[model samples]
Each structure stands twice: as C-alpha cells, then as structure tokens.
Target: MVSITFHGGVGEVGGNRILIEDGDVKLWLDFGRSFTAERRFYAGWLQPRGHSQLMDLLEFDLIPPLRGLYAQHHLEGSPIPYEEAHYDAVFISHAHADHVDYVRFLDSSIPIYCGSGTKLFLEASETVGHMDYGEHLYKTFRTGDRIRIGDVEVEPIHVDHSIPAAYGFIIHTSSGSIVYTGDLRRHGPKGEMTEEFLEAAAEAEPEALIIEGTKIDEEEGGLSEGEVYEGVLRVLREAEGKPVFYTQNRRDTDRFRTFYEAAKASGRRLVITTWTAHLLSKLVKDEHLDLPDPMRDEDIAVYFRRKRSGKYREQDYYHWERPYLERKVTAEEIRRRPGEYLVCLELHHFPELIDIKPRGGHYIYSMSEHMEEEALEEELMRNWLSHFSLRLHQLHASGHMGRRELLEAVELINPRRVYPIHTEHPELYRRLLRGRRVENPERGRSYHL
Candidate 1:
C-alpha cells in the first residue's frame, strides 16, 4: 500500500508539504512555508523569536509536529523531543521560498535532491542575502535523471515555472506511479518544457496526480512572457524622455531578461542592485540558462546605495556585493541622466527616490497583484510612488497556469486520482473536472492508494 499525506498547501496558494510513504520508504515532496499563516502570526518587524522559533510556530500549529524531522538546534528547549532523521530524503521541486523555505528546520542527516540550478539559487541566496537553507547532504540531478531510495525510484523532470530549474516528479511506488507537479505554468517563455513534462506524465499514466492550482480561480486571461516583453517595451517607448523604474521578483530571470532587452532596445542601460548583479553573475555560469554575465554585459550596470561611513567603501558591502562596486552607478548619476537608465528598485529601496528625484517618471510593476485589497505594503508603495510623481504601469506575466490551460493539462494527464495543492480555489477543479476522481485534500489528512 502507498499512502500520501498533505501537510500544507490546502485551501491556499503556496506552502506545499507532501509526504509519501511506500511501506517504510517515507520521504517528502516539498517542504514550503504557509504564506497565509506567516502573514497572520508575524508581520513587519514582529516575528518569531530565533531561539524559540519552533515552539512559537508549534503553538500556532504553523509547522507540522513531526518527530525526527526537524534539526536539533531548532528543537532546542521545545516540548517535542528531538530524534535522528527518520525519513530517507527530501526532493525539492524549486528554490522558491514558498516551496523550500522551511528546509532550514529539517535534519541535516537527510539527503536533499534537487536540480543543479536549484542548488546554485540556494547558494546565491545564502551568499548575498544571508539566508541559509541549512547544511544538508545535497545531491543534484538534471532532467531525465532517476534517483533510487530503497523501493522508490523518483525521476525529476524539468518544468517551466517562474524560476529556473523547477521540476515535477514521477515517483514509482510499490502500488503504482505517482506524479507530483511542483508549481508549473504553461504560459512562460519555457512553455514547451512544461508541455514535455505533461506529455511524459500522460505516458506514465500515474495512479495519483499531485498538482498545483495557483491560478485556478475566477481570474482569467494571462499574458505570456512574450506579451509581457511587448507590454514592457510599449511602456518604455511611452516614457522615452523620463526615467523608467521597474519592480519584479528578482528571482524571475525570464522577466529580468525581458526588462534587459527592453532597456537595450530603448537605448537605456539597465541599472540593477549589487545583490541582483551578484545573482545574475552566479546564474550565468549555468550554460543551459542563457543569462547574461553582469561583468561582461555592457547594457548592465550595478547600483550602490550610500551606506554608513558616508563613503562607498569596499568594506561596507558584503563580499558578493563587492565585485560589482567597480560597475556601480550612484543616485546622483541616475538623477542627472534619468532617461539613459532603467533603474530596478525594490520596495525597501524606496528611500532612494528622495535623492534621485525625477519630475515625472514611470514605475513599471511587473509582478502579481495583491490578493488582499488591504495589503499594507501595496498601499505604502502607492503613497511613495505618488509622492515621487511616478506613473504606475502594471504589466506582468503570471507564473501559474490559467483556468483553461490548467483544465486542459489535467484532462490530458488523466490520472486515476487527482489531488490539487497550492491553490485557494480547489473547488474549481471539482466543478470543472466532473466524472474524474478529483479529491480536495485537507491538510494533515492521509489518503491511501
């Protein structure tokens, strides 16, 4: 008998944690944080204490209370007694915080399996952002690679997503084959990759299909990556003589490429932060990914903020950020010639707007809209942009599949039993996928096949 447990990603988007057990072979699919829970318990500066993090989270039932799963350090002083790793391994689908953030709490003894690009992403995050995913025995695999753990043979297949090196899994268990789609979309630049994955999944004819339904709501019609590029180009053309400031998920390399190309076409240098430049530099090494090297890319220039000491000293910045110092462009330079640069500004860097005051610039928001109307950050962002007299242009491509596309994919795969995860509207699937074995899995419930 093969059993599957849904720990998270129920009645919400993101925070996916699934455990598969084939007899004694127990392992996890993805260990992600619940974004919905995180927002409720902690906000802004108020966060869980570092020393009593596990206890705090457990109090609210944020994390699963599984013994022998968490690291000893994290379980220190907690009520739950710590034990050695009981699981075989952890298979990470991608490096997104929602999909892999809670890996820090896992036991270091359990080996981690992920794509080569995913490993690089984690390394870059640790190097630049000081965010560590904990030290685990990592085993990197590429597309078409099959991993064996006891009786289970897991195949990692590449899939198109918001981030590079995202994958879906084909797990061969004693009962039957199980397919797990780890946050995939068929609308991005790499849509073909997702198609290939679906074709393979269809051929497998798995007994169980574990998929993500991030955009399975009333929301319809999404722009493809190409469309997004075109939209961005149009926006840049309109703001010909004014500065164009854009905000997007820094990890979305495809969007980065879109902005870079748009900037180049408009005869403007894409000014990125030192941290972004470092990430790009690290990503460029992956020959499979066609990321431009920050060091050699003429159209790219790094931005440096005036830190403490009142001087742009090399010691002020981290080692990863120091490399881009030579190619740094100051706020004064951007202020003097705003039209010649397309500045990438994050919400935290809104203070820089005061120094680089532009008369009437354009702010391109190339990201998803907040699900909540009363999102504090979005309200605050608008106030800042309004004060700067910046026109906001919302142009973005979603990282998830639309309703029609998702339904089509589900029909094509046609698994024996369908279980939707990472979605707020799982009922949509039940309503649309009539006559199919669709199961709306509840969190912490175990379903056997």
Candidate 2:
C-alpha cells in the first residue's frame, strides 16, 4: 500500500510539505515555510526563535511534528527527541520561497534533489540574501533525467513559471504513476514548456495528480509576458524625461528581462540593486537561460544606496557586493539625469526618493495585487508615492494559470484522482471538476492508494 499525507499547503497559498510513503520508501515533495499560518501568530520582528525554530513552530502547531524529519541541531532542546534520517530523499519542485524555504530544518543525511537551475537559484539566494538552506547532500537533476531511489523512479520535467527552472514531477511507484504539478502556467515566455510537461504527464496515465491552484478564485488580467513588455515600454516612453521606478519580485528573472528589454528599447539603462546584480552574476553561468552578464552588460548599472558609512566607502558593503562598485550609479547622478535610467526600487527603499528628488515620476508596480499581510505596507507605499508626486502604474503578467487555463490543463491530463494544494479555495475545484475524483485533502491526514 502507498500513502500520502499533507503536512502543509492544505488550504493555504504556500507552506507545502507533503509526505509520500510506499512500502519501505519514504520521501517528501516540498518542505516550505507556512507563510499564511505564521502570519496569524507572528508578524514583522516577532518571529520564531532561530536556534529553537522547530520547537517554536511546534509550540504553535505551525509545522508538522514528524520526529525523524528534521535536523538534530534544530531539535536539540525540543520535546520531540532527535532521531536519524527516516526519509529516503526530498524532491524540490522550484526555487520559490513558498515551495522550498523550510528545507533548512530537514536532516542533512537525507539527499535533496532539484533541477540544476533550481540549485543555482538556491546558491544565489544563500549568497545575496539572509537565507540558509543548511548542509544537506544536494543532487541536481535536469529535465530529461530519471532519478531512482529505493523502489521509485522519479522523472522531472520543466514547466513555465514566474521564476526560471520550475518543474513538475512524475513518480513511478509500485501502485502506479503519481503526477505532481509544482506550480506552473501557460501564459509566460516559456508556455511551450508547460505544454510539454502536461503532454508527458498525460502520456504516463498517472493514478494521482497533485496540482497548485494559486489563482483559482482570483480574477487575472490575462496579460502575457509580451503584453507586459509592451505596457512597460509605453510607460517608459511616457515618462517625459523623468526617472521611471519599478518594483517586482527580485527572483522573477522573466520580469527582469521584460524590464531589461524594455529599457534597452527606450534607450535607457536598467539600474538594479547589488542583490539582483549578484543573483544575475551567478545565474549567467547557466547558458540555457541566456541571461546577460551584469558585470559586462552595457545596458545594466548597479544602484548603490547610502549604507553604514553613508560615504559610499568600500568597507561599507559586503564582499559579494564590492565587485560591482565600479558599475555603481549614485542618487546624485540619477537626480541630474533622471531620464537616462530605469531605476529598480523596492518598497523599503522609498526613503531614497528624498535624495533622487524626482518631483514627477512614473512608478510601476510590476507584481500581484497586495495580499492581506501587505495591506499596511501598501498604504505606506501609497503615502510615499503621494509625497513624491509619482504616478503609479500596474503592468504585470501572472506566474500562475488563470481559471479557464487551469481547468483545461486538468481535463487534458485526466488523472485518476486530483488533490488540490496551495490554494485557499480548494472547494472550488470540486465545483469545477465535477464527475471527477477530486480530493480536498486535510492537513496531517493520510490517504492510502
């Protein structure tokens, strides 16, 4: 008998931790942070204790209380005694925080498998961001590779998403084939990759399908990547010799490319943060992505903010960021010639507006509409824009499929049973996928096949 349990991503947008057990083999799909659940108890500075994260998370029932699943160091002072690795391996679907952040707690002995590109993203995050995925034995796989562990043979195929190197999985077990769609869309630059994944999944004639429904209840603008580029280019042209500021998910390289190409077309250099510059430098190694080398890209410039010294000294920045000092652009330079660059500004960096002092500028919100947790931040952002007299624009292409496309893909795959995860409206799948075996899985409950 084969069994599957949903530890997270039950009825939430993120925090995906699914456990699969087949005979003597045990593995997890994705170990992600419970963003929605965590927000309920903790916000901002109030967070779980770093050293006792497992204990803190367990105290509020934020994560699963599996005894042998976590690292011994994290479980040292916890009531649940530490144990050796009990799982065979963990398969990560993508590089998104919602899908991969909690891997830090996993036992180091348990091998972690992900796409080669996915590994690159993880490495970049560790270097530039405050994230630490811990010291797990990592094994990278590509699209066509078949990885075998114990009795199961897992085939990973690439899918199109907001971030590059996203994938879905096909697990061949004794019972049957199980297909897992690890967040995908057919409206981005690599829509064909999604088609290829779906076609291959259908050919396998899987017994079960685990899919994401992030945009199931929400109405999308139905904009494509090309459309996003067009909209942004129009905004750039309308800037009228003023600096154009934009905000997007720093990890969304597709959106970055959209801005990069649009800036190039408008005869403006795209200014990015050192964080993004470092990420791009690491990602450039993958020739398949065809991303421009930030160090050598003539159209790209790194923006340096006033840091600790406020003097723009070499010692003020981290070693990873120091390499880009030669390519740095200052606020004064942007203030003098605003029209020459398209500046990347996150919400937290709004204070820099006091320096750039662009009386009338265009600010593009190239991201999803604010979520419940971001309501306060949105208000503050609006206040900043109002104070700066900046015009706001919304131009974005979603990384997830809209309702019609999602339904169409489900029907095309035609799996024996459907389990919906990473969604607030799992019941909607039942209403839409009528006459089908749709299972609205409850967290911590095991379903046997």
Best TM-score among the predictions, by candidate number: 2
Instruction: Name the 10 consecutive residues with the lowest summed lDDT in model 2.
Output: 369-378
- Quote each prediction's TM-score: 0.97, 0.98
**Each candidate: RMSD to true structure?**
1.7, 1.3
CA lDDT of every candidate: 0.88, 0.90
lDDT per residue for candidate 2 within 1-449, as digits (tens), equals 89889999999988899988899999899888878898888888898887888799999989899888889889988888889888999999998888898898889999999988889989988987878999989999889999988889999999999899899999988999889999899989999999999999999998999999988886552789999999999999899699899998888899999999999999999999999999999899999899999999999999999899998999999999999999999999999999999999988788999999998989999887623234347778888998989999988888899778888888999999999999999999999999999999999999887
Clashing pairs in 2: none
With a 3 Å backbone cut-off (N, CA, C), the pairs that clash in candidate 1 are none
Tens-place lDDT digits, model 1, residues 305-328: 988865889998877788888888
Model 1, residue 237: distance off in Å is 1.2
> Model 1, stretches more than 4 Å misplaced?
219-221, 370-376
